[model samples]
Target chain A: MSCVTPSWSVAMKKNQLRVNEFGLIERFFRPLAVNNPGSASLQDDCATLSVKKGYQAIYSMDTMVEGIHFFKDDPADLIAKKLLRVNLSDLAASGGHPRGYLLALCLPHGFPLKWLENFSAGLQDDQTKFNVSLVGGDTTSSNGPITLSITAIGEIPKGRVIRRAGAMVGDDIFVSGCIGDAAIALKLFEEIGRAKTLKHYPSLYNRYILPEPRIGLGKLLAGTATACIDISDGLYADLNHICLASKVGAKIEMGAIPLSICATNIIEKNKDYWESVYGGGDDYELLFTANKDQRNVIENFASILNISISKVGCIQSGKGISILDQFGHVVPVRSFGWQHF
Target chain B: MSCVTPSWSVAMKKNQLRVNEFGLIERFFRPLAVNNPGSASLQDDCATLSVKKGYQAIYSMDTMVEGIHFFKDDPADLIAKKLLRVNLSDLAASGGHPRGYLLALCLPHGFPLKWLENFSAGLQDDQTKFNVSLVGGDTTSSNGPITLSITAIGEIPKGRVIRRAGAMVGDDIFVSGCIGDAAIALKLFEEIGRAKTLKHYPSLYNRYILPEPRIGLGKLLAGTATACIDISDGLYADLNHICLASKVGAKIEMGAIPLSICATNIIEKNKDYWESVYGGGDDYELLFTANKDQRNVIENFASILNISISKVGCIQSGKGISILDQFGHVVPVRSFGWQHF
Candidate 1:
């Protein structure tokens, strides 16, 4: 972990201290640990985590590197939040509530100091919203691209985690929130350029830059969802995940897929945009299967949570994910890119 | 972490598949998760960690960047092992036994696939030795140095963790194994150059390459030691951590500090090397403090565990670590570099 104890003591002097590695911790990292009692103010070697009795501690990690996962000039705060939310989404899909997280940051040489201030500010905002504390982390400077990894820790009651393996034949498939906004946003940025895309379609751009992790809804789906996953690799791609794990196939009606007004408008004008609506990724929305009889219970959940839920498909007794037309014609989309005619 | 579900299914055909992200996981990573039942063969969203009913889950994380933490040409196996051991040492120092770990790897473009085979081989060797499993991790290609981070999870009995804050005045300070081998090996590499140094002192070279985390001895010292820390930063620097955290100072008898035969010979020829003996780092040995009355019991532990135990100092009621001369004269080393000369 970088160097924990200094060569000789570099006493922290608030605000005026030089921005060395130690100063970064005192100014930007230490305050994040206040919510986690086991963090020991990021002083000791390891953090002590007390997992509640009968609950299993759970965690998922994701790493983001500048120029790869995100643009170098993207707002540092949004980048930080997206890194956190994406990992939180993994735990959320497993029906867990986050407790704390550990961060490992490799800062490239000559990176702007103001970016870090904004980055930590973003972590502060999300920690409050997600009810998580910064436990401990390692920070070091590198001569390469800026890299960040966060391991988000949470807990779920034993045996209650909604997994990707429990979907059964005839189970109704559902998705949370609007899908394809992020992937479409990225497509627009690629086609029309980022500046124009952001100016004309800011909502889609915002969806790409910031994803909302559905933790509350995921926890609510614990016993209800026969199988669950977060839609990170597009609807059809993630649907295949459930199909493969459960040894079942999925038939999704292309007409029933939900989309944001922005995505719907764009797709209507350019039929090619419909490709992104089905096959584009980075949707941090929950996708799951439940017994067909649970429709009323699931609908009530959508109304109560005030997020749209759409029944777009059903599990079938076979192998791959099929994108179906309104007339029940199946379009093969597995083992290859979408085989749409 | 990594985009787990593939875009389109690329069914694996043994060694013939292209080395894409999914192929890498199927070939190198899936086996690592077999021991952890909750890992679900590394196919699920998050790993479920079961903390023993009466124990608290503990974890520590470390990130090592190529060219910073290790030589670019260092064996891939040793680099992977060092990364895991350094993190395990933290949990070891806290009176815990590791259960599993999560790894995040950022591989530079063109990094050889062969290196990963050796790296995972190293992890397999250590996991067998330490009884830990790989829970989950993320791997991605990066334009930067290969940055690796491991978050090790373990458990310690409730209310029994030996924290750095528990050291008290009059406690006998103890250290495990030899102290300066790593720093001196690094110094030798810098002075005599790597080839000649490796030819001459392979023991010291190996010592620098692979640190033996004191997991067995650390677990043995659990209730016996009042406070503890693993020496990653040099002896004096790490000692200062206990002093700062416990609000106590230390008086170290230099004559009592243990040294290896290799270090002793080096110090005899060049007294300048003595600086690193006290001020150098990467000694993953446990440095601890126990009540003075427990001297006999501690001695018995050394004999039982078959590792040398040196009582080099005592906790004192003030602040800072004083390195004492043969005649018990204190040398000032508080606010600056060693004033020992």
Candidate 2:
């Protein structure tokens, strides 16, 4: 993967007021807790949460390090939104409803307080958008680049939450939104103004920065989908999780996999880009499987949610993922998906 | 705040085997979930947690960074134990019982898989000791030093949780266990061989590395203590939090503050070290406030728990923490506590 450092010029500000940790929290993060009674206004050592009767809680945590998961120059709000949304995406894959989240921010000493303010504002925006609130967190100084970690909490009915091991043979493989836009957008980041297709479809740039999690679709698929996962490490990599966990195989038709128009144009321009389009990650879309009989109900759900739902493959009584070409033959790929290592 | 980089000579090993991300997780982390049904053997994107009926869940997060939180050459196992125990300490402050936790680990590329093995072993040890399990987390490559973040979840009876804002004016400030051992030990790090006192009190050095969270005492204080907090950011700084939150002040007698024989010996050598002894952090002891009448009950609780309980101060109807000398005059200090900034 190409590593391009974004312009940090805008983030370099002057005359910023120096603030201590407590002051930073009070001025910035406290407002995000306006609606969460359990947060206790960030006063107590721990936040309080009450699970409703007959429901189980879903917990997940992810960390994003500067220059690795995101560029240092990325907008604070977009970064915040991406952090929260990615965790929510995990909850979505689990067929759970978002409730609240905890954040741990490790910043370099002398970090700009304005950046903290913008980051908090970003969280505030998403706290309202996703109906989740900030509950508790720790703020500490790091000797390295900025790192943010979040643990998102959600709720699901007991015995109803979907797992990767639940996929069965003959289940229809489905995806909630277009795949690979984030990866393609990241590729075009190097080409930017020189790419003709990007001139017409500039939204792909924002797609790489901020992913739209399929929360409503996931909730809708709670009863319909047999197995589910979020596409963060590319379709093949994530699908392999379900395959390995369920002890099943899958055959995804390369031509049937949904793609954004911009991704299609880029892939058509160069066959080499197909690898990234198929294997690159960070799509944050739901990849799931359901019984063939539930196709009509899923279609109705997609229609009601006004989102695209594609049937791309089927679960087979085997192991590993196969990409079936347009000629109905399996085509081997160089890599499955993004590997952090 | 002396920044001493410890020797990394022991951490470096030859011909260390390389492992992919998934392989590392499978070999190192999966076993930590041996008894946690909700962990699903670390396969699912989210972990399942069911809160018992009539109970409220408590959530908290804390981060530890190499060089800042711990020396870069520190044993991976000790680092892991400290990370989990710190979060558990917070749960203890809230009068919550340990349940489970999620961890996010960011390590530099080419990090030794052996280090991961030792780190997982450390977590396994604490999971057994604390009865908490690892549910879910994200492991990603970092460009800088190792960073670890954990979000611990705990359970408490409904409406029986403790907070830092419930202390009354006449409440007595009580602290569990000895304090300043960690800070004093940290101060002695540079004088290891030169200081004869450290040779006599080697346990203080171990106390600095490993903190024993007062889980039983905290549970006992749930209904009796008015307000409670864990002493991670020094006693004066944390007590000031309760003062600010509960709109109260405190007058602590310097002579009455609990201290181990080792800490007492170190402080007796130099009166100027009293600031760190009093306001230095990382003790992880429980500093709480309770009605004067509940003193005997607290002593009984401490007796049963086999821990020391000391009443060092009384909450006043004012604003800041006042440290009284042996002669009843206020002693001005250089710093309040450990400040992240």
Candidate 3:
């Protein structure tokens, strides 16, 4: 009889150090879900989700692929955190509080057990930090580099969810935290030979790798901000989204835009580099528009949250986005932000 | 001056026919989501989900990879339906009715636009058929084969969800519809040289590609069936899941195991083929256990749903499963369905 090796046997041969999918899940994923009664210890095919009374759930999913999203040699722990944080950022923009998330991992053959262990460790850390739990997910082998998808569920009080289309003319456009650190850091990483220069901006590099989702600020802005969005596809592109959705326009003042010390230092040396600082993506900062009358209230709220807020622009009656210098002349931008096709 | 190509330009170069991801979403995905108010016309990053009063949401996620799960040439429509159906099946097994789902697609570079169109059409068909809608999802490019992950949401009355561990000793083990068709069809396809034999089992082949989730039957069985699971990993393996979860054992009679005429003919040719029929995977039928006293009630419910219900065994107070032939002799099965490594 000709022996025919099963597909799974072939998989085992390639990764002798790898635990089977089920065992891996049982050891690493099940523990993260213990607090979630609906997860059923990851034993059942689906999990049950409970929503708080007078609350609606917010849902969002994002995918990260190796090489395209991050470097192959990046630490698994950071990857896990970045994946969850990005989705959490969505909730932040919508004024939702993190509740739980589902994860789907597609790993190439010979994927390491240690990688999964570290990834789960990262998730455990964030689950505690964000006060959310793992709901349910699936792990499978793929023929390509590692790809991950996270579906995050957050809760908002009934009819209280913030949206991107509520900005009105004359609304004050504000941004939380410093913008462009992630974009600059990403640029430094892409120019692999610029390792020497990257050492000068450690903070920017850290910001790119691990973004802090402004959940606190977002919750505070729910009833106050007229419109809101998290900065992922750069400030300009994302601002354009609010404009498109609200059928309005915006003019950002370059001088008033918040920048970290490191970003200021880089821009001072090469003023032309401002495009990358402003239009490069992955900031994860909250960009929102609020009634000008609420300026003082918003400022106090930002202080309470201990996050920097900048009134960089105003919503106008027209469409599209424009950037202005301190003298109020429109400055043409090279590109809007990172575009994934 | 050396002209440096922007990252987005590089992506555009690789997929000349592809539009930017945002525009692609607007054209293809947004239409399907328009009906769901919470989807926000796919404008905002996250979608809002409003659960009915006195109901808890059920969530499940599953991933399918090209080549690993389906052939490269598999019709996009079938692939899309399969992706949704598998997750829907999970909800059905959990006694939840489909409400909505979030999909994440990681398509290979140069993936066809027509394929995506067909895939969306399939989703539209199933959404109408099953009364579910697309709430939200993310789409991105991958360097490898296509990979898709779906997170399906369903709802059931608060505290009324079915589970796998509720079976009691002496409970009647039941399954919906005929078994082994998908597995047999998969085998026939794998041995491509025997394409002539596959023509004889058109029904089996169809079952393999498109599984009709017994949603109506599952809903009817919700509070009545003591324990339940969907039979994706063959009858024996899934039965073992219910057995393991309920801490019970079972004995299934080979003669009583329901099979279509095509499966019967194949098994008759080789009595050993019974292992494949009973131990093969991807059946997508519901394997449930109910109290023996509720047999008439379950039969009546099955009749109302117009689906076949077979009682193949009884739960015993033990720790494993056994297969017995018509003459009461234990049958030696080789394996327990498909085990993904």
Candidate 4:
């Protein structure tokens, strides 16, 4: 194959080439220099970082593809922020603080300049807010979906990083906030014409576009809770992740789930909305397990942290996740959870 | 669009899958337990890793795509090793010791099993060689290329991590090992059917498939070298990285460049082979700069490290890279170094 000459001048004319991934990276990240506490220089062929003595670094990676993770025209700015935020949420679930990130971007032909500008702006915004830097990344052209792969590096205070397998039988299960808003927002956005007939909930849309990562709550629960996971793959599936890792099962009470009034209203209006709550994805909330003895402590801590904490279920020595109805009997779920496979 | 019901088993197969944009990430990575260091009984909701005082952490990531980076049927085992080794080479370039890594894989439908087994065996080989572990990662199905994204975390003594911006004018430029063998090997590999006459150079082929990372040399140079970089995108482009980062220019003498006997033989047989050395990608060697006074020290150290070091160039005050022929006249390069863009 011949090496295609990318028209940087024409791309610049359209404002797409203002900051090729490398240019923006050089502008914002170059000044940080190397050797700051936890500093990974942007110039090295690679970054050098030290894991704390007696502590191992916690690492994770996620890739978001256009037309799969988000719509192709979903405001390039929002897409960039959401990409970083989702990875940050993963770090929060594991009780790891953002240290640095690596980005791999695959650009399709004729990538727009304004999109790159707005996308970089979004990246800069989140990086400033989160105090994370774009350390290094690769930029390549592809004939397929524009894919962004982010690997987030974080440090946990020695022995404080949470994992999925720490939950014990009988631990009280709690979720940090209302669930399913993102999925609801997705539906609403997909059917904007019908949104006028339904109640307008900008918060739901905001939840979908820019969900808050519960980094503080994660750090707060790091020392106290037994097991935790972020709700990226729907409640049931994410909760099952905790069970699988912790070697326990869970029984969640339907009535106890903290559904927002908007979610409740939506569900009442469309019976199928229950599927969104029970099986929808991309909520970015934290679900965790804690001992019953720590209930009062958790409540006080939650108040101090100013994040909602709701009891949704209890862990049991079993093999699968189950739900309870108002009658306190097992209710067969219509779906297990969202599966990427 | 419907949530496509992917055949999990078929998608997970190894050999049936061909390499494309997303490399062989999905077939190998399995979700594993998070072994947090701090909390005993590993019951904490989050892993709490205690950061040691006065020590900073280093992080880096790189993604290799099929066709864009490597070919599809390029020894599945070697492909796996190259993926990890290249990232480790990045860490080495920055003077960091490997700690662990997170992998994100995108696999096409109907991958094979034996391929995965061989790939994992290769990973096992490198894991033992480098003393690193697979920490965490994500796996998904894609309709595009097989892609592998690896984020490696490493540690350097506090304030000792190296950067490319520190090179001073007059600093001697040094590169480990003979350059261009990997590129020549690639060229020869591609012309295998027509160039049956050039089949004797197995060393060249090995260089292309498994370029050894100079980790120990990078570590040794960390304290002495003013700046460093890895030669992945050939010498010119990578040297430009150091120049741009350090705000300096460089002059390389063609005579000083170290060429392997296999590379020289190929060049003698085909004059065009010189282009491969100057413009080839995927040579995971380290290129660094140090003060002229340290030349003897570096020379002695190279012998001690058991690695060949060639003084190929010198840093100068200016803006770009230039090459000189034997008589000291400037020789125009035929191409800018290889670029993914």
Candidate 5:
């Protein structure tokens, strides 16, 4: 049977042209006000926020558009939840505690109220879970697809924030959680329709739809990790980031990669499994490198935190990233990574 | 002559898929290696920033998309500059000084490299002018209109950040600069063939393309203005935000509104003048309210700053907004303001 496609065009057919953005702001956005102690309210010229007395703030923004990032028929709540989470993932990678976020939403005309309600509910859930507040946002209507932009702010102890350029030549690289599950999940969802079988295993599909940002691990690794990044693109591509930023290189053992059982199963069932593992996107894992001696400590910390930590590679004194096969020979690998532009 | 209208469908082509946002971290977004004492290199997991050691950070985000917020033919440099300035306007409205920002760009495949070079140049200009450094960003290709999301981080002295809820019952409301130029400029551009007269006034057209964010005024009014907001939507709707947030109403003498010479000229020549002044959007002026005692100081400051300041109205005890006609009577308005949805 042909899979049912979501009709985004139908979902977006409304009299949005007749109404200007300001009117919508007065009607819908104003009523959902939250009193921010740092700033007076969203109605002000700009929000004035008070960060903690001594700590510095970390800020990041991410935007998603319908039919560009995800299917139009994708669940509205999931889309909203992912938008916030992706931004939070940035904060997490920065090793900061989520504090607050600003949202800018441009909705296509004819968006259902149900979608708004679900989206807001998902936002509320994530906000409460991450201990973040919604400070301010702009909601407007458009003649195009629905788009969401979220700017998240977080605070970290003075001098404790980590960055991407600190990797030493001998630092051991590590990634949290099994790799490639999200990409594999997307494949499964696309191939099998509905993802009903994976519903019983929420870990796989949830990772694809709603990633669990590694905020705690990121914070814990702030002063310890030599360099770090969130794995949104595939693992190899993400690690290449550390390599480029630190002016170093990396060598990963293909056999040591931590793959989810479900991911392995799906990959075994499909001939193009490599694509899911190497080129899949939307995995919000943190890939970092630490001093070689800190390996045992990182392992212990991961165990204590009940999160997976895999020793996938090590930093070297060269440029570019390389993956070693089981025979310990340098293998020619395609630059398998996701690109936006 | 017929206007050259780019087909919306052609303008919406997607770029090559990017699967490696992290991979380019080193290649594209590395911090300046020389490191100023203030530079927070991308070394730690997150940026460790010091906001005057004691001040809190203010944050805001804004996103713009092609075919929605801007046209395909819009100059890329102006687009980049406006995106950052708009976010700064938000900070200015809140009484904060810009420190840094994160950017996320989703570009279509056909986006010209020259466009990017010009866009980056514009960003570099603003970064220097505003003392904001680009800390990090994600770039991806999309199968849709180009989208940009900018998240700005700013600092404000503790207890000095202004908000919208502080307006007093009798505070005088003011706006910086004449309004309606941007709206008229857009109209002129849309009807350029028939409105050949507009080509002679490039400054008026520039208003629509490049809006000066009122950061200086925002910071100046931080300690003075009881309530403030950036006029993105229009006079009526944005001010209504201050009224709703401050739990007060306002009565504006329509005659006192500051209209640009260009706007006045266009209004006199056009049939729908009131619509342009009252409903035209994209005017990035600061609309603020202050205690009556501070009026002289504000006027002097405006003079010192070389920006026009107009007192348009006063806060009143009520729940909604009203416009006073020449005879000093409340007249029924057609609509409150523009609505995007």
Candidate 6:
């Protein structure tokens, strides 16, 4: 009864205007419209969205340029999934449920249509896994890198959503999933120059290529966590956002930080890579704060989500993040977050 | 008191992560969030949206690339407005009222910050004119041409939304405002190559730079018109979209198609430019259909809106379009829509 996004079936039928684009949508994206009724098979220029009675719509947009966000030689499917996941991570941090998204891609002139097949397939996989749908989007050609922008829309109960501005002093800080694996993958990628196989630690390569969004964990943290953010800009940098917003300080211990076996092994051999743990980003994990009373609930959340949830630090009375070592001595922070490509 | 976007004042205080980007938002974009409660001043990664009863949220996205959608040297402010207006035009076609929007900018590396001030000023002006607010978005640097993507959101009464599939045979095809001016400007741009002032017909140049979205007219037509669309691709191509969606044919006399004084003068000097009038795009006007009995009402809509509404053709029970010359012979079509960069 309500109109949302009419799918591409309307425009693609003509195939006389922007023939390649219509064809691309028809063959690749039209199938991804299964989640919502307003998709009308991508026939209309605009799609309609509606919110439920107790919920409000949540949105975030992230742009990823080839070579800046991912290597050009990466699998098209992984590239598409990573782009979607990063935006989803933001919504998760807000404790919203996955819903639908809009994607805009600017490709180099004469972009191969085959790449879209792989790209949309990646979207197909994630849309199924996350139980979301492709509501609307468009694509165009340029001389620039393959540029991707996705506006992710979700929903959260009006009363349950968390924010970055609610942390209180003495609140325990928790991070979901492992931290430095993706950052290490970036380093490995630069060293190997897009080798089809990473000569070692394929899990590190996998984590880099595909990130698992902490959507379930994030939703569980809602109402319980006082403040929350996603770890896209490295742990310290993203946590600093919490401190600045909540007008508090934080003390996170390096020993309490969760790490994958591969990451730990690499760090044991070379201390220089510690900077990656502290400053390198692309984690796509949830970072949040809750009072000491919520510690047991958070531990239960970790078990329920089947992902590691570490007590990295606690909110302090002052300002900024203090990165303490195993000996409780402050470790000099090397870097913060994304430096432009 | 419902938490929406917790503006950038929170994360921007640190100024250590993505410093250039945070500074850009603080200087230019933070000023444009005047229209919505959810726009927490561009600080948070995501914003929340709520829809009112009896309405459904309408959404559409448009992406523009330098050298593809517009010239690289075009004024940054005009470029920004056009990008926003184009997406707004899509929403207007669906009979949606202006609401809030998200923007994603992929700028060339070392993009001058001053250009952003001009660009944001353009958005500020239009956001005020349209009474919409900036909700959320992100920007990243790339080596590619300037790429801007906008997702415009609006609201339309559930029962009154117009769709392209609803037009029936015998419906009178109508277009709002003059059609050929922007197309003429495109051709003139090719001939002049970035001249500051047009030696002739500055109106055409102006139309190409900034398009007026018929948002108000679209809302008025929602319940009265059978179907509607905005002309972004030339009128012929866009009309063909309606025909394809509605499963109908169209017959329009070239002489009946409205043209601006400047466009008429150009066509008089050289008939070769007729193709530009017929197939050239970038005109953000509404084209719709109504049954014969509604002619008087359509005329009233025109007068009420203070814009000319011309009946160019009638929908027939078939497919495709027939463009008739002054002598009633069918004019052969050259192109229908956008080609790549």
Number of the top TM-score candidate: 3
Q: What DockQ does each candidate score versus the true complex, computed on alpha carbons? A: 0.43, 0.41, 0.49, 0.33, 0.34, 0.36
Model 2 regions more than 4 Å off = A1-17, A190-201, B1-17, B190-201
- Considering only chain B, report the TM-score of each candidate against the true chain B: 0.92, 0.93, 0.94, 0.87, 0.86, 0.92
Model 2, span A1-341: residue lDDT tens: 00011112224335343566687778888898878899999989999978678888999898888887787777898999999999999999988999999999998766877788789889998988999999999988777889999999999988878889989999999987888778776666555532443466567767777889888988888888999999988889899999999999998999998988878887888876787657778888899999999999999998999999999999999788889999999888775776665
Estimate, for each residue in A249-317, the C-alpha lDDT of model 3 and write its tens digit: 988999998999988987888776688767877889999999999999998998898778999989999
lDDT of 2 by residue, B1-341 (tens): 00011112224345442555677678888888878999988899899877678888999899888877777666889889988998999999999998999889888766777788889999999999999998888888777888899999999989988999999999999999888888777666655531453476678756766888888888888999999999987889999888888989998999999888877777789765677667678889999999989989998998899888999999999788889988999988766777665
DockQ of 1: 0.43
Q: How well is candidate 2 docked (DockQ)?
A: 0.41
Clashing pairs in 3: none
Ranking by lDDT: 3, 2, 1, 6, 4, 5
Alpha-carbon error at A64 in model 2, in Å? 0.6
> Each model's interface RMSD (Å)?
6.8, 10.1, 5.2, 5.4, 11.1, 9.3
Docking class of 4: acceptable
On residues B1-341, what C-alpha lDDT tens digit does candidate 3 reach at each position?
Answer: 00022334654443343677788788878888889998888889789877789989999899998877777777899999999999999999988889999989887665667888899999989999998888889887777788899999998888878898899999999988998888877766656533554477778867877999878887888889999999887899888888887889998988888999988898887665677678887789999999989999989988898888999998998788889988999988787677555
Q: Give the worst 10-residue stretch by lDDT in candidate 6 chain B.
A: B1-10
Q: Is candidate 1 or candidate 3 better by lDDT?
A: 3
Candidate 4, residue A44: how far the Cα is off, in Å: 2.2
User: Evaluated with lDDT, which candidate comes out highest?
Assistant: 3
Q: Is candidate 3 or candidate 4 better by TM-score?
A: 3
Worst 10 residues of 4 chain A by lDDT: A1-10
Q: For residues B1-341, could you state the per-residue lDDT of candidate 1 as single tens digits?
A: 12222322434344332476656887898898887788877777898888877888888988888876777788999999999999999998988989999999988655667788999999999999889999998887776788999999989888878889989899999999998888788789888988887899998888787999998877888898989999876788788878888999989998998999999999999987877777777878899999988999989988998999999999999887889989879765532222100
- Give candidate 5's error at residue B320 in angstroms: 3.0
Q: After superposition, how far is residue A232 of candidate 2 from its true place, in Å?
A: 0.3
* Model 5: CA > 4 A from native: A1-36, A39-41, A189-203, A269-271, B1-48, B189-200
Q: lDDT for model 4, on a 0 to 1 scale? A: 0.73
Score residue A88 of candidate 5 by CA lDDT. Answer: 86
Question: What TM-score against the true fold does each predicted structure earn?
Answer: 0.92, 0.94, 0.96, 0.87, 0.87, 0.93
